[model samples]
Target: METVMNRIVSPQAWKDLADRLGVDEACLKAVAEVESSGGGFMRPPSQLPKVLFEGHVFHRQTQGRFDASHPELSYPHWDRSKYSGSVAGEWKRLDAACALDRGAAFASASWGAFQIMGFNFAMCGFDDIEAFVAAHKQSAEAQLAAFSSFIRRPGLLDALRNKDWKGFAAAYNGLGFAKNSYDTKLATAYLRFGGRSP
Candidate 1:
């Protein structure tokens, strides 16, 4: 099935991330399929509080999937209303984030496509949010590298390996939006992508 994600052709980004992380192409592609919906990663350009709030919403959804005691969250909560509200709130902040350009202090702070913190951005050697977005659109490699690092940590891959595209998408996007029969969409996308039966 060819999804908006599968058809995303950020080759430069993919290669940059591959070179840095040494992740296999398939793995990178898979992660990309999850993050950004194969679209250019766009971070909510809001300040720390807003971004943290957004993360909190996503985190809540992520955490709600587990059995409370599960070591790591492997799925999204099934509560449709909860996550839908969260997405609406988050997109508002994201829109605010993007419109920032010498407005409020938090507004100018720079969260890019990957929701990268400014501290991490500095640590990673990026100049600013604009720089990050430009780079992400031009080359997804950095995004891929960062995602590879997040997913490659010991138990993470194991948790993700057993997940189907539906589960995976829920984990990547918030659960509410992800649950709307996305498996069917992914199936169509997979067939279009020439995916074999798993």
Candidate 2:
């Protein structure tokens, strides 16, 4: 699979995503910029999608699959505080999570430029989690396809199309979206990408 980091966002990719989501090109471009710096990658070298592993989610997803004696397979000893804002730290935690269960591990982390959770594979038009990961490894085009599908499934496309950053962020970025200022940042990015200021 090609590394997502080096993939370029062609004009047609934006146009396609906008068309699929029934939104303006600028809206798609702004989200792309804010989510993955317009390229769907974290830092260089790894070229993997930026991911934050939710240990709680991992435990919930993998519960009852393994015995307590298998400490590595259990989440009880996992220290969420050990993982911070760095991608490297997140990767380490992700590796440990994968050891417990690959499906649950992948489902616990958000993927690609859109940062959609793996648990949302079905909502994102993927047949399953494995399929979602395969698409993510393909290219930015695939990632945008997943993003568009995710927004449509949750009926969040309207918020984006109307430039309702707060509504969009609330639905897309979760309730704590304000703490990250995702709404404001997206608004700023929209203006930068030629969208009308909101």
Candidate 3:
């Protein structure tokens, strides 16, 4: 898999995503900027996307497959509270989680600038987890494609197209959208990018 350590989308890529989503390019740009600071990579030198691995999700995904006898190969035995919430921590946890179970490991972490959960592979139009990871390794355009797939699955595209920031953010960011002010932030970003704000 090719590691994408830099910004993957060009202006054209954003336009393509907008066209596919049937919304203004600026709205998509706002999402990209707010979700991933305009790209997926966390910073220079790292080819991987910023990720946050949820140990609870890993345990849930692994369930009966976890080998209690060999705690190293089991998600249930893994310490969920040990993460530092940094890039280094993400890599560390990912490496350890992969050692336990590849499928569960990948599914436990949110990927790319959009922070889409790995478990949502099917929702993002992927046939399986491997395909999703492959897409992540491909390019930013691929990442955006996944994002588009995600929003479309939940009918969030209509919200975006209509400039309904609260609706989009509520669905996209979850019920706790107000905690992060995602709706306001997205609206601000949209206006800054020359789009009408809701």
- Report lDDT (CA) for all predictions: 0.41, 0.77, 0.78
User: Candidates' TM-scores?
Assistant: 0.40, 0.84, 0.82
lDDT ranking, best first: 3, 2, 1
Winning model by lDDT: 3
Q: TM-score rank, highest first?
A: 2, 3, 1
Q: What clash pairs does model 3 have? A: 5-47
Higher lDDT: candidate 1 or 2?
Answer: 2
For candidate 3, the lDDT comes to 0.78
Task: State the TM-score for model 3.
Answer: 0.82
- lDDT, residue 153, model 2: 46
Least accurate 10 contiguous residues by lDDT in model 2: 69-78
Candidate 2 residue lDDT tens string, 1-198: 345334666787788777766798988888878876776656656656667777656767877455354443345444556466687777777887787688998998888777888999999898999999888866777888888778884448888888888999999878889988999999899888888754
C-alpha RMSD values across all candidates: 10.8, 3.4, 3.9
Could you say which candidate leads in TM-score? 2
| Residue ranges of candidate 1 with Cα displaced over 4 Å | 1-37, 41-138, 153-156, 159-163, 174-178
Residues 22-139, model 1: lDDT tens digits? 5434444544343334433343331122132232233343443333443121123333332224433644544543343212212222232333433244344456545444444443
Query: What's the alpha carbon RMSD for model 3?
Result: 3.9
